[model samples]
Target: MKNDAKTRDELIGEISRLSHLIEDRLVPDNGMTDDQLRSELGLLRDLAEQLSESETAKVLEKPAPSGRVESYQRIFANSPISFSENDMSKLQTFFTGIRHSGISDFRWYFEHHPEAVAKCAILVKRIYVNQATLQLYGAGGIEDFTDGLMSIFHEESYRVFREELIALAEGATSFEKETVVFTLQGERKDIYLKIMVVPGCEETLSRVLVFVVDITDRKDAESMLEEMRKMLIRTSSKSIDGNNSKREG
Candidate 1:
């Protein structure tokens, strides 16, 4: 624990020192010593050199399309978000091709985990948020389906889910994990919702990024895994009891 605390303090100090360095670069002050400048550059250069080619290869796999981040920033700053796919498509300036990292990740997540697409419903702008966009992005359906998912969101649930996001935006609180759940025709089904928020993130990051992973299959697997764990514990206990009985005998 002492080591962990020391490590955490070191990381925090590094971040604080780096922030000061950025400020120092913009507005020069003699507060920073000459050696500090050299130290910082040396550390950065070492970090760059230490990065394995395989890691860079992943980011460099696809060239981000032009004007992606700039356009996205513009839309985020200017538009009243209406999360509909058609409207999102209209924001073509935000993402032209699948070259942008954010777009690529969004595309990958949507296609791979359709259930994750609509999970951002609470935080989404009412105008831009819709089933169409979710479907196009493969983020799953916003509404519950009659065939399997008769899910409905109550007022309290909405409050609990959305309030956290608004609070994060307002700087009242921050969270690493947030969840939303659904009940089908009053019965709890496998459908669930989740989101990740980063309020004090850097310039390249958005305030929040939500994921809707359909855990139906995963939930089933978990149930089986849990049962196995229980069985193992019971067997282990029985074995221990036998060993103790033999020792007593």
Candidate 2:
């Protein structure tokens, strides 16, 4: 028992250290690329998994101090990456009910019943949006953002949401995807999104963290490079054809 507690303490310390390291890299002009961000997040994910073990859960049963809670709230509010808290308890209940009804193969069931997937998505409700999330959707505040929520989601997002529901049904604690979204003014943006069920909240799914990173600029650069490559290929082909024609003449 002593060893278990000691290991849990070490894991918690490592999580804090990595969290601070990631935050430090977010400073301006740090040249932090998406890959670097992903690398750090990957480490954090591993830590989260370790912390979710049964022994660690027993060690963390007590609530955090008020001051520590306040500190975490500040970090979420000011983080550059958009973040939102969601409640998926209703969806969790729905899954349980379905299982009770003998729906063992969720993937096959959802595939055959598309409407069920949509219903599951609607069961999820947004509980809170941080400052970065409000700005990302060009909203003056959370109220405006909530009111205009339907306007911001591109049609493709529903497809991504379906995949998320499927993953959760299959026992995945996290999901990630690149998706399209629109601002209130109808400007399109490409973003990479990741959603994780808070480790302790996995049972109820009452608090899920949704992370959004705008990737429009990166995507645009890739598109331009692709077009340039095609143009060069065409030019080279035309030059070769001309050379062949001249030799025949």
Candidate 3:
């Protein structure tokens, strides 16, 4: 037990150190190579995983829960889908600026200015997430989950997702689309996302609620079915050609 505690403390210390390194390396003018930055992030992820295992074991060693803990235990802690709440005030402001400039699709602007999205990522924070989010993203806690947001999305998917989010913030009511998200362990999952803006009592947008459903299996099945259909069509065409040649002969 003493050794376990010592190891846990060491892991925590390493996690903190790596986190600082990651922050420093992410600066635009930072001199670190991409490989070096990725290496540090990888080490940080490993340390976080070890810490998570230790904490989970500790929780399991405790007695059965009661009261609020017991009541909350049955929530979406094990659900297959992910859900998150995000603040969209900054996005709304961005939309307002674009609308003033008569920009129909803000994607072009954002693509040209990658820093804009990064800035928005800092301002438009994700405030809450369900347990499934943490499990899906392999996050130890909400802080870890939020910190990994930029790295968790595929490049193209992130761009499209941002565009749609901006549109929704500009009074589009709701938005839904399929995109790819990367887990903390670097596994990619195709997800169907539904985003809705919740309005306050004053009839103004307050927060955005997002639902992320892992649709990787469904997408793969669809692709397989499409391939089978194309194959069947090709076979039928060949058979028809063969019969015609026999009739001609």
The best candidate in terms of TM-score: 2
User: TM-score rank, highest first?
Assistant: 2, 3, 1
For all predicted structures, in order, the TM-scores are: 0.31, 0.67, 0.56
Overall local distance difference test of candidate 3 = 0.59
Candidate 1, pairs of clashing residues: 64-99, 82-127, 82-128, 83-128, 83-129, 84-128, 114-139, 115-212, 116-212, 117-139
lDDT of each: 0.36, 0.65, 0.59
Question: 189, model 3: CA deviation in Å?
Answer: 2.0
Pick out the ten consecutive residues of candidate 1 with the lowest summed lDDT. Answer: 82-91
Q: Give the alpha carbon lDDT tens digit for every residue of 72-164 in model 2.
A: 345567765687777888888988988999998877877788778656655767777888787888877666644323557666876777788
* Alpha carbon lDDT at 128, candidate 3: 72
Could you give candidate 1's per-residue lDDT for residues 1-249 as a string of tens digits? 245334434543544454354445433554755455444434333322322232322322332233342333333332222122111111122222323543444334434643332343322322223443243233355433322111344444444544443333333322322233444435322333333333233221233332232334334434633554465556668779889999999
List, residue by residue over 1-249, the lDDT tens digit for candidate 3: 456445544544544444344445334364644455345434333433443454432433342232233222333355344666676666677767877888877667777777777666555577677788888788887787454257686786667667775566445757777788888799988886776565341124346656676656545534533554465556668779889999999
Model 3 misplacement above 4 A: 1-79, 92-108, 111-114, 201-206, 244-249
TM-score of 2: 0.67
Count of backbone collisions in candidate 2: 0
Residue 125 C-alpha lDDT in model 1: 27
